[model samples]
Target: MKNGPLFFFGLFAALTLSWAGTVLLSHHQLGGLAPFYDENESAAFPLRQPGVAARGQLVYADLGCASCHTQQVRRPEFGADQAHGWGERQSVARDYIFQARPQLGALRVGPDLANLGGRKPAYDSDDLISLLYTGVIPGAKAVTHPYYKFLFDERPVVGEKSAVALKLTGALAASAGSQIVPTERAQSLVAFLLSLNNSYDYPEARPFVEKTEKKEGEKK
Candidate 1:
């Protein structure tokens, strides 16, 4: 109790140092990072998100998708992200330099989306829209994700049906003379989800596997 002032000052100092070490230091390190240029592809890594995709990221945050999904992939040895196709390598600071606010979710209630756009057998825009509207994947018997039905509008078709209208069949279909179409938010959200690609093999992302040279000529 006698050293109360000193104790409080020490606590404040510790907190200040922690903040500087984590946040400020990180900003100083990554703030000026530029995209990695690839000679073979003649393009830079981590392409900037398109205008629509950027807006979609806002929608994604608004919907709290990060609560269920993660945007960072751990090292393969640390996790099974590579085996499961979540990502091919661990995410590096460079991977997120272009994101407005990186959604490095804390929990993995659903799968990580750090590389969703680069996933094999990629999910097309229509596929994503259908999944969002139905809460079910194309062939899955169970619902995989929440159906943001509010993002869609069910209305009568005026002319030749909307080009963006949902091509639903079975009981999920809209009533005759009507078509289901994605609203602006739905389009934006889908665009954002489709933009989640981190396939670029940045130097920092690759794990360092030390090579062990076999003895000079151990019986070939």
Candidate 2:
């Protein structure tokens, strides 16, 4: 009561300083970031997303996919992201300058997808669709991905099976004379998921490699 005005002013100042430290400082550091151009490759890193993939990124957000999966890869020393084959290098602020609303999620309910597009033995689009439809592929180990069946449609076969109809077996197969097909939104979402590659080795992303001294007279 006696010092109410001063107490309120101190609280307000503290909140303003905190906001400036986090938001304003970050913006000043990263707001003007530009793509890293490689002379040998003659191109820039982190290409812009295709139209469909951009739409799909929105779909990914709308479906709350970030709640389970993260798009960021932790440093090797910080975690086992490299060992898990999620990414070869740690993600950096440059990796996300092109992303309108970067989904740098905080949990790892599923695999990190920052480099999914560049994964070796890359995921087949059909396989990804099936995984999205059923949350698991045939004979694969248990999958934690939630089923996104709402993205597909089960409809009676018209003249012939639609070209886009999914190939299904087991109980997931549609009833006789019926087919399961991915909607345009489903396709877009998959496009976004596949576009989540952050494989470009930005200088900032590269890990610090400490040079070790060889033991005396060990070898030349």
Candidate 3:
């Protein structure tokens, strides 16, 4: 090969082509993705997040919750995510079409929350609020998670205790006359977590099933 002007021109063209194919091509393909509508359900899948939940998403990002948790679920064959009850089906691009900023985390220190609200015996608002305030799941002792007690406020019982006050006891108790209640930010954050459900089945999200050879004794 000669170290000539033609060789340098060819190299520049190759780099430009590769960059266009990888970056521009992908944006053209998926940049305008829209929500999947379900005729049977009479609504669009991945419904838009409510105003409070949307604000909570900002709080979630600010707190760096994505550092420990992921919002994407892998295919069953690729990982034990399905077996672990993280999600029923693999996540698809349409699942995040309504999100302002999707939190597709890299680490798996905590469970994937892609289908948290759609999980079997789903985590209700109270459950999430309790977890945020207390740091641990109801009965699980060994599994200690981060506690966001700062999200709550201790206030004197003005007329009656707030309906949303945390039922504190033992060391986590508030002062004698004050009640602990979650702030608006905390409520919004919990609302956002509860809105995370990717149970809707998209055609592209279906897992690829490979054919297997059957033994002589096996029935067809």
Using TM-score, give the best candidate's number.
Answer: 1
How many clashes in each candidate?
0, 0, 0
Residue 115 CA displacement from its true place in model 2, Å: 1.0
Candidate 2, 1-220: lDDT as tens digits: 3699999999899999999999999999988999999887899988988899889888888988889889998998898998999888888988888777788887887888888888876876787898999888545967656788999998999998999899988888999999999999999888887887887777677666565664653321
Please provide, for model 1 over 165-206, each residue's C-alpha lDDT reduced to its tens digit, 9 standing for 90 to 100.
999889999999999999999998888888888877776676
- Residue 40 local lDDT, model 3: 72
Candidate 3 lDDT, 1-220, residue by residue in tens: 3978889999998999999999989879999888888777799877899998899999999999999999999988898999999998888888898899999999999899988888987788888888888897866864388999899998998998899998877888888889999999999998899888887777578665466763554332
What residue pairs clash in candidate 3, if any at all? none
Candidate 3, residue 191: the lDDT equals 88
TM-score, ranked from best to worst: 1, 2, 3
Measured against the true structure, the TM-scores of the candidates, in listed sequence, are 0.89, 0.88, 0.85
Off by over 4 Å in 1: 3-8, 211-220
State residue 33's C-alpha deviation in candidate 3, in Å.
Answer: 1.5
